[model samples]
Target: MTKLERSQIDFSTFMLYRLAEHWGKSVPDTYRILDKANAIDGYLVPCYDMLHTLGSEYLVNDLTDYVREQGICI
Candidate 1:
């Protein structure tokens, strides 16, 4: 991919990470939901898939840390 595409990938991954936190959805489940949406709307597929695949584990880890840090006591 070009530099811009790669950059966009990184940004989109971050977006998905935040989105997962916002919706209280896990990485794997977010993929299933976004994958379906992307299927119905092709334009979002690349970013969505990249986010779902590339950032999943990291997002989960980051989210765990965030929750722990916040001390929400969930």
Candidate 2:
């Protein structure tokens, strides 16, 4: 993969763990919820440039909002 692609993946993984921790869920569970909502591919990856610059709490909140906006329960 290109360097940029790798960077995005890394950032996405970081956010996944952060969100999982914030939600008191396991990493795998967090990943499943995110995948079910299409947040990883449809939102996170596409918005990586802008998102990677945001703070951790803000990014987690943004992701929480995005997932909820998609009508996901968790």
Query: Which numbered prediction scores highest in lDDT against the true structure?
Result: 2
TM-score of 1: 0.50
lDDT of 1 by residue, 1-74 (tens): 88766766666566556656766879666555555445213433344445455555665555444444545322
Please give the lDDT score at residue 9 for candidate 2: 94
Q: Against the true structure, what is each candidate's TM-score?
A: 0.50, 0.97
Candidate 2, residues 1-74, lDDT tens digits: the string is 99999999999999999999999999999999999889999999999999899999999999999899999998
Q: For candidate 1, which ten residues in a row score worst on lDDT?
A: 39-48
The C-alpha stretches of model 2 lying farther than 4 A from their native spots are: none
Clashing pairs in 1: none
List the global CA lDDT of all models.
0.53, 0.95
- Cα error of candidate 1 at position 17, Å: 0.5
